[model samples]
Target: MVASVFSIYVRTVHRIWRQVKNSGMHVDVSHKRTGNCGRKRIQIDLTQFLEIPLRQWTTLDSLACSINMNKTTLFRRLKSGAIRRHSNAIKPILKEENKRSRFQFCISMLDESSIPQDPIFKGMYNIVHIDEKWFYMTKKI
Candidate 1:
């Protein structure tokens, strides 16, 4: 009846029951498989991975080869969120004079109505600067 309800073969259920009886352990839970039953996951040491040169980590194949790991496994690890990718960017440094020139240019661009001129110049009052401070430009590598 238990086998019919669970849709398992009676012989299979009886075999499991006999094994449990012999082991002198009662089934406390309905789960057939024990915890940690499947194939164990590979444990990767991240410090070793981080210590690898930047040049080697640029490509998956190169990274895998450098780390002495399989390319597919490494790709899988990346896809599964086990690994992370970083993008390198460099910020352009501007001198104090350059910043002052930029500020002057920005002020000059203000609505022509404010600037007294023979020909009316259109002030770009509509333009909004997202970052008022630390205006260094960034270049992505």
Candidate 2:
């Protein structure tokens, strides 16, 4: 059994040596076929993507169809860090009076023990119903 194992090992080493010599590949090399092993990745140009309006690329499926790629491929790009997802949020623009009112409301909600130097909240139970909205001056698509 030992002799057979030795012979098998010798045969594998000889075969590898022969292949290395014929293929002109380094004996100690690794990942020799790594570049050719996997399916080619899709390349998306950032400039082209940026040029497309947000409405056109509203969803992953829409964006993939617009760019002429499979949704799975596009999703793979997102997973592989080739693409990223962003949620755009607009902050409410408060006027001077609105700001003062908000400041006063916050002050009223403060814990009694809290002082001017270090203000603390009495917890947010009373302030849960607050909602603010911002409207653009011009129509937005």
Candidate 3:
């Protein structure tokens, strides 16, 4: 069945990832998987990318490629509010939920301390950068 194949594939990927880590091999993944498919010729603006997709594509990589801009440029536009999101880009759940919702849902985030951490780079991360002038270098190169 499909489930068994998926399980085997997941196991294979995990085993490979583990082996690569254990062997201290750093894989430099450079190329991306997808492109805008000739949309780059039209020079689609940021608004067109956001509006036509109707806010479905939330990732920065996709938005950047679709609008033919790099991630840094897209982030700069977003921070400067040059690009605006369409109205009701995210449609609400319901009118009743909007009208009569007395209390907001209380949510809790529990990160995976339970899941096994990566074995490689275990002890190397504990050392902090001990420069006093590290602040001026935060947003700069």
Candidate 4:
């Protein structure tokens, strides 16, 4: 009756009853497990991780190989907030000459008449973009 009313297992109710009967006035029924209980979490050294090059950090498998750690363990660390995964896109390193050329190209695209008022690019109907790879593949030579 007590187990059904409390929505707890009969065995649990029996254990509590035993405790209360033994203690008479006071019954200490609290959780026994502490925060430190359970399997110890694997620790990751941030300094060592940071020392590895960006290229090695590209994939979890590569990183695991470099650090001598299991890929699954590394993945678990990532999921548990012990480590962070960053997706950094590779950007082209443009020189000053390249920058100047890009700027000149943008300047040429602007309408000359609109320079005095609101400057905007031309309709660009003359430009045709063709993939060099596709063009070369279709050619006989």
| Top TM-score hit | 2
What is the lDDT ranking, best to worst?
4, 1, 2, 3
lDDT of 2: 0.71
lDDT of 4 by residue, 1-141 (tens): 999998989999999989999889687887678776999877888888878876677678888988889999999988888887664433346779989999999999999999999999999999998766544332211
Q: What's the number of clashes in each of the models?
A: 3, 0, 0, 0
TM-score (C-alpha, index-matched) for candidate 3: 0.28
Q: Write the per-residue lDDT of candidate 2 for residues 1-141, one digit (tens) a residue.
A: 543765756566667777799888666634369678777777878787876777666578878777777999889889989988875444356779989999998789878786767879787765556345334322232
TM-score of 2: 0.45
In terms of TM-score, which candidate is stronger, 2 or 4? 2
Query: Each model's TM-score?
Result: 0.43, 0.45, 0.28, 0.42
Q: In candidate 4, which residue pairs get closer than 3 Å at backbone N, Cα or C atoms, i.e. clash?
A: none
Local error of candidate 3 at 115, Å?
31
Question: Candidate 4, which segments miss by more than 4 Å at Cα?
Answer: 1-29, 90-141
Candidate of highest lDDT: 4
lDDT of each: 0.72, 0.71, 0.51, 0.80
Superposed by TM-score, candidate 4 places the C-alpha of residue 50 at a distance from the truth, in angstroms, of 1.8
Backbone collision tally, model 4: 0
Cα miss at 42, model 1 (Å)?
Answer: 1.9
